[model samples]
Target: MKIAVDAMGGDFAPQAIVEGVIMAASSLPADTQLVLVGRQDIIKELFQKHGFESSAVEIVHADDVIEMSEHPTKALSQKPNSSIGVGFKLLKEKAVDIFCSAGNTGAMHVGALFSIRAIEGIIRPAIAGFVPQVNGKHAIMLDIGANADCKPDVLSQFGEIGSLFARHTLHIDHPRVALMNIGEEEQKGSVIAQAAYQLLKENKRIQFVGNIEGKDLFTDKADVIVTDGFTGNILFKLGESLYGILKERGIEDEFIARTNYESIGGSPIIGVNGNVMIAHGISSPLAIKNMISWARQQVEANAYIHIAQALA
Candidate 1:
């Protein structure tokens, strides 16, 4: 399987991204093709510096780079040769099975939507990531940063999609699903959330576990949490901050090293027609390597196909 890496999108740019690509090319399965998408000259220099051949990691020349502040729609239209645009175009053409980037998150989302397009039944493509809870259990959070305003139907779809991901990817049977809310009562929060909660509670596809407050995030109360992108992103960042503080306290050496930003690598964007993994801007070589492995596993498991069928 071929995975395209955006070598110039992140804050660290070509340097860290190139190192990660080299590491993946060397350590990953021999058949896995690593397509490094970025400014060709700089990427080649990094490869040469590391004593790796250009053949080891294929270069997909992209003339422009999208700034983090640039709007996705604007970048896609104005900067056709940008890394985000070129990399996404490659995915659309089936040049690669997966597209990975540490670039502007908004640009990535917008580009993927137009490039790979969303599945037929999907209302909005959700950006999802697994948050580790107590006893190594994970809770899948959806709409982490995709769509902000969502209708009740959108939230219900998020729960359904998130549940499928937990079952197929994480091997969870009857994964408990919860709507992030202000209270445990059914009438709590905005009308949209309340209505969504009602539908989720009555839905048969997922094991709807009722409302989950922000405090319950790490309590092992739910395996999959669904919310609109606005709330989901807030909770995601909050969780990250909490984890950061925990690390700063120097709690557990093992968990600290394992759960750090550099270690976690990337988050997979679900609901799209293909695989697109988005990494942290500050991701290290190890994290990039992990992202490649994660993307390969998703392809091997046929996660996107399984999800497409499940959503259908």
Candidate 2:
């Protein structure tokens, strides 16, 4: 399998990405290849700086770069040779099994939508975040930041896709799906939440477990947690912040260690046509290395194909 990574799309740019690629290349399977998309000269220089050379790693030249502050659509359209642009191009052409970036979040999201596109019958593709559970496993949370405002039907679709992702990718049989809300009761949240609850309950394809409150997020209450992007994004970030907050106080916990962003490295944008991972813009070399590992899992699972089949 080949995984394409945007080399010039992050805060640290070529340095961190190249170093991370080197770190991952050392441990990758012999059959797997890492494709670095960026300026060839700079990428090679960085590799030489680290005194590293590997046949497992290849560089794909990209003449331009989309700044973090640039508009996603505009940058992608104007800069076809940009790292993000070339990465998506390779994905669309099936040259790589996966494309990942720790650069602009909006650009990554847009690039996926405009490239291989969403799966058939998908209302809107959602970004799924891996939430660390108390049981030493992770729960899949949908619309983590993709669709901030979701209708009842859209929210219901999140449950269905989230369940499929959990089953195939996480290897959970009959995953229990739950809606993230203010209360555990049926009538607890806003009008949209109440409506979404009924829709999710009526859906037989998923094992809907009703609503779960914020307190139950990491308690292993459900295998899949459904929430609008607005709420889900806030909750996901708040959960991720535990590691930094606790570390500053000289506190170390086994479960808290999993909260570190570098552990998982990146979050996959589910319901898309192909594998696409979005890592934190502030991702470290460790995070990129881990991201590449997780990307392999995603490619092997091929959840998007299963999701498209299920929808059909």
Query: Each model's RMSD to truth, in Å?
Result: 1.9, 0.7
Candidate achieving the largest TM-score: 2
Model 2 lDDT tens row, 77-110? 9988899999999999999999999999999999
Worst 10 residues of 1 by lDDT: 254-263
179, model 2: CA deviation in Å?
0.1
**Residue pairs with backbone overlap in model 2:** none
C-alpha local distance difference test of each model: 0.84, 0.94
* Residue 243 miss distance in model 2 (angstroms): 0.5
**Candidate 2 colliding pairs, count:** 0
Off by over 4 Å in 2: none
Pairs that clash in candidate 1:
none
User: For residues 1-312, could you state the per-residue lDDT of candidate 1 as single tens digits?
Assistant: 898999997888889888888887877777888899989999888888998874557899999999978888988899999999999999999889989999999999999898889888898888887676756666789988888898998899888888877787777888899999999999999989999998898888888989989888777898889989999888877666655787678666543344455555778888888889889887778878888887887666656777788767
